[model samples]
Target: MSAEQAESEPQADLPGPPPGPAPPSSAPPSSAPPSPMQRAVQNYLRHVTVERGLSTNTVAAYRRDLALYTLWLAGEGIDDPSGVTGNHVGAFVQHLGTREVEPLKASSIARVLSSVRGWHRFLLEEGQTETDVAHETKPPKLGSRLPKAISIEQVEALLDATRGDEVQQLRDCALLELLYATGARVSEAVNLNVDDVIDQEVVRLLGKGGKQRIVPVGSFARAALDAYLVRARPQLSLRGTATPALFLGLRGQRVSRQNAWLIIRAAAARAGLDIEVSPHTLRHSFATHLLAGGADVRVVQELLGHSSVATTQIYTLVTADTLRDMYTSAHPRAR
Candidate 1:
């Protein structure tokens, strides 16, 4: 039987343990089979996870967004991918806006719509549907916001704050230095192996969609890594089972993205900086500083492992604003 037909068929009841308290009458049975639309969503999720090689967080986001979409489709009595239409997709967008608790922002709504569009496109390409109904459903426009970057002095202070001979402190210092030096996403940095950096001048980073790129290590960061590996990592490694991770938590396993964020925040607090700092803040500062120092945008893009130079060009806006502020303050003008 076809997968959908098999799913629709009622299963043979077998003897089981006595039931507990009855569920509310309004609730559907827990064993209810998934609709055909839901099955398609599962297929698409697997495709992205396995074939597309998207990161865990990215795959989770796609799953969440698509789950909501399928639930909405079921409410509308649309149980098949072929049954969806542009009007249905548009109505779903409207339904999202009408949500009462913690309404989504325009950017968030746009992201949901983007997910929906990708799903429909996938369905069409897979021959599961005749048309991509969501093709014309436009996402809400988002206003441009420049990336936030701290001054060079602020960055130096933050890095300095992580300095100490303690095991965790050595790891933190090296972590922050590598972050500012390489512009790696926190996930990429935390996911690193010891061999990825040890005895190498260039660090290999595995970015989104399993794309790999090499970024050169600066002298300061290299020195920090050498110290951490020599004095700190050996001690940390003995705390738990053996692992090849470059950075380790107190448990001796790989440091997590959350832990890395905490490291950055604690350092920022110690540095007495009033601004919020996260791992991405260092990445932004890295790009901004490079552009401000007259580095070529294309070169920065390569270093950043950005798939397109357009993504790197955003830093130029930050640099331009900085130059404008400097010009207004330094140059004699008839104002």
Candidate 2:
């Protein structure tokens, strides 16, 4: 089936575990014949989007990985998906993991292999192929690296750094506070509406794949947002528009994600934190602080709008690190 048909099919009306995986796809280039790999990948992507209801970004990632796989398969003269064996897939993964062409990180390799496996599963589900050849495949065991998080004191310092005689400074404070308070992704925070931020107690986040989540606002964040909503947002939006954007740029439209990230970086620089700061740093700090105060992981996962509890479990590593540091400082065993 074509990619469009696979995607637009009425799979919702049928009952079964969701479609496994499909081949990756590529955007059709004008005035060129598509190679067999491109055709198969496009078919795969269509299945993913239509049947799986996946986000376009995810589909895009799969497309890139599958493209690389197909290129390697072409080099090996293996054009047929039906003939692509588990050894071939595994070899492809190994080559991707170790190729000197570019220094591919483990995470990148994992992503590529994952796309291949997804495609394998897709074929099996469609009964176009036999068993899932990738069934025994495994992603590289990634070291459990904790997400970067800062302390409450540093956060206070960062917010205080935004204190100045300028409206932009006030806006930055509000943005910083909202990020740390709501544990929101940068895009969600920037796209927020005045209506979306509830009674100053909660903010509605439109997360990945357009999922809506309600997250509680911390005390400090509520106050910061109140001040921004009362003072700075109006000034920023005063030009000629009656925009509903909770945050605005110099143009008074909704702020861009890059600008939001830049705002956090600038604020961190001014505060002399000297650490890599992004909008997610605030989120990491939010989750870590909550967990340190005994917040439930599942509850945090719900608030963060994570589809899986396993994704949220990474923050626990940060909490564990905090405990270890405390133990090293206070425990009186002879060195």
Candidate 3:
């Protein structure tokens, strides 16, 4: 029976789970052109998009990972889904995790292997294949890494470095201040529209998975934004056709992601700070400072638009390590 037909069978009428993994098949690679792997992958992607209702970013990640896996399979002279074996899956895992070609961090490799496992599980559930070739494949364990943050002094220095009467300089200072104040992702910050800031006190942010949250704007950020909108934004807006984006390029277009990165990096350089800085540095500082000041994890999770409180809990570790370092430096006890 076809995989779709097997799926249509009633629960009680279907045969029990196979006693063991499907026996290895010796069928030679078909002489004809291979097509099943690509077809099956497309079908599985559609299933995830329509039935599972995943976000676009997630679906895109899945597509990218599966594309890499398909390339590896083609390289191994296996193109059909049914021809995939446990050994093939194992080798692919090794290929992703090792430095034989381009080395990837453990988290990146883990995500790729996870995508592979999900694809195989979908195939098995759909009855596209009898064996779950990737069921036992394991990704490398990820190490615990603390979020990187700059001190308040550094952030102040960075923002102060951008002072000028020029429209672009005003906008850059406002952007830096808003990022630190709101703890917004770079994407979220760049995506903001004029209406997202309400009453000069709070701003609305759209986050991943299409989630939206409101974060308060501190007095410093509010003042900076006021200056930009009044003194800088109108001049910038005149450069191009009008747009609703809160942050605009010199041409009045919505600020692109790369443009935002350059703004942050330039400001950091002018601040005379030697540390590596990215847009996320401000976000990390926001979260760490909040937690260090006793903000609840759940509150920070909501403000940051994280789907789970567990993701926000990582900042607590940053705070604890800071305390440990302080104790090591200040305590009177002999080493």
Tell me the TM-score of each prediction against the true structure.
0.88, 0.80, 0.84
In model 3, pairs of residues that clash are none
Best by TM-score: 1
Q: How close is candidate 1 to the true structure, as a TM-score?
A: 0.88
- Per-residue lDDT tens digits for candidate 1, residues 255-313, read 88878888788888889999999999999999999999999999999888898999999
How would you encode candidate 2's per-residue C-alpha lDDT over 1-335 as one tens digit per residue? Answer: 42123323455666656687854658654887776557767888998898777766788888888888888988999877777888988888788768897857788888888898899888888776788888788888787677999899998888897876466767878888888888898878888899998798988998887789999888888888888888888888885388889987765667777777777777777789978978888889988998999999999999888999999999998899889988888889823
Error of 2 at 302 (Å): 1.8
- Per-residue alpha-carbon lDDT of model 3 for 217-247, expressed as tens digits? 9999999999999999999889889799999
- Rank the candidate models, highest lDDT first: 1, 3, 2
Clashes of each: 0, 6, 0
What would you estimate as the lDDT of candidate 1? 0.89
Off by over 4 Å in 2: 1-36, 238-244
- Whose lDDT is higher: candidate 1's or candidate 3's? 1
lDDT (Cα atoms) of all candidates against the true structure: 0.89, 0.82, 0.88
